[model samples]
Target: MTGPLHEQSVLVVGRAGGIAHAVAVAARDAGARVIAAGRHRQRLADLYAGEPDIAAEAVDLTDEGSITALASRLGSLDHVVSTASARARGRLGDLAGDAVRLSFDTKVIGPLLLAKHLSPRMRQDGSFTLFSGVAASKITVGTLAVAITNGAAEVLARSLALELAPLRVNAVSPGVIDTGAWDALGDQAKAQYFADIGARNPARRIGTPHDVANTVLFAMTSTFLTGATLPVDGGEPLT
Candidate 1:
């Protein structure tokens, strides 16, 4: 509560992703010890390859046993953050069951299971930050699954916050961030998407990874803040 997370340890799930990687790096720079977990062993390794204070662990959050094992390995935890998600964009009727299940598993079940397993290991003053998305509050045609899952995540965070007491719990909802994830869309589609969102947002630009990362860092350090869903969406919520 005094120093800048120095000597503290943080467990970041889905650290291979752009936003998650930024968060891990920022936390480490602030003098915190970081343990990053993701399914991609090589990616996780590459992320923290030379970082002395960072450790990378490959984990499959979809499996309850895997989550439990990971939690068990971290005997004690000071902070927990998750950016896990199985994002699939498709029309409602065209979407497959597997895709929907994948989305739910990562975005909803994974975070919940992680929280449940890691709760005991967390220090009384520790914190848990989960990832949600603007889709939860904004309507988009083909992002139905994502929206639903994110909304569920927000609700879960709120409920967990109350149950966890002194262990703060919250969700960070990011807007359309310029992470490599958007590369999946064609240049034309991506341009139009960004233009639309940017015009609507008061900030007048798409968000950056740092925008979300800063919010996550703030949530982790603000001891009195709990059960909050902070939107790092470039003021997109105003629209």
Candidate 2:
């Protein structure tokens, strides 16, 4: 337990899989105690069973009370990374009000509240890494709600970073990573989609959960870095 984050306490809030799980594992491997929290505590616990370094906790991002309670439970923390997002995908006419609201509530407002309650307990030298996405910059149809939510998240990171001086606040914006998020496209369709995106993007390949996890860890440890949205998106926005 003598890595860069040795003995530090890192909290990663999101679902059991995808980027959150990767981050929790990465942090633990880096010698930090990790807490993987989400809406379902038992499910998260089950997902991370037998992982001594990673303990599961419960927190409903849509509920302020839940965020407050989570903060109370962890009296002190060294760093926090929130990868929670509820995307509202569809055209303008197809979008539902509830879905859009939930998208913002989960990704934007939830992290804001996390900063509100957690900052008091976080070490001044600690940091918060919030999740943004390439959609914010790519700006294509069917991703309007997602883009706006991510845009707001980036802004939130900057705002919080300035307000919470010495306590770094940054964002990690990933491109189309090969995760369950794309499984909705079906096997063949998803493969084609990834292929198309990969062929066009500068990196020429889809990102992985580990790709994002590395950036999250960097954000936590890079003391000089703050208020910036680090893009893990294979330069997709440039195309």
Candidate 3:
């Protein structure tokens, strides 16, 4: 008899990010065929170069045509994981119309389009996992776009879960994972920032990409878990 995740085909969006890489590796390790999608061709190519079990595709989530094209390539899927998000950090009033549109398009509209195109192709036992951030719950200045998008994504996941039913749909809200996205920050600033937040968190440390990845894998395999927003934030929400 096959294991729970064996022989399943999983499609992962935003495959260039650290968390997506971790999830791809974990899904592959669990005997699933992983198809990683993103807008960065070289990054996706580099990621799949050494991994025969993993495949990579270049996709722009902001374009519905691109998403539909990707769906065509996928044909059928047992799981879909979206780690895509727009990182245009700015104050509420300072954001340009295009910037706001880009942010909303990638975070909210992109996943919705993916679901619209892929839902019919997904197996009844299949599942979808979308990524949100702790900013949705935590009040942070200059993160209005992110917070709004995260909140909307979570709500969309819940609604889709209800509609999809037997096909589980969920979102993972992560906090302060040490990914390369923070490499641009000054060392002192980064250290102080994480140190302060970690101290407040009940787990007393920042989460890792693997931490979030494992939670996503759990959502994929969990037959009974649906419409749940799992916070893989090292208990930061408790603070």
Instruction: Provide the TM-score for each candidate, comma-separated.
Output: 0.94, 0.98, 0.95
Candidate that scores best on lDDT: 2
Candidate 2 per-residue lDDT, tens place, 193-224, comes to 99999999999999999999999999999989
Those runs of model 3 whose alpha carbons end farther than 4 Å from true positions after fitting are: 1-3
Model 3 residue 99 lDDT score: 79
lDDT of each residue in 2-107, candidate 3, tens digit only: 4557899999888576899999888988889989999996899786898967899878989999988888877789999999877768897887778778878988
State the weakest 10-residue window (summed lDDT) of model 3. Answer: 1-10
Across residues 25-76, which tens digit of lDDT does each residue of candidate 1 receive?
Answer: 8888877889999888689888678877889987788899999889878878
* lDDT agreement with native, every candidate: 0.88, 0.95, 0.88
Q: What is the C-alpha RMSD of each candidate to the true structure, in Å?
A: 1.8, 0.7, 1.6
- Displacement of residue 42 (Cα, Å) in model 1 is 2.2
Clashes of each: 0, 0, 0
Best by TM-score: 2
Report the C-alpha displacement of residue 6, candidate 3, in angstroms.
0.6
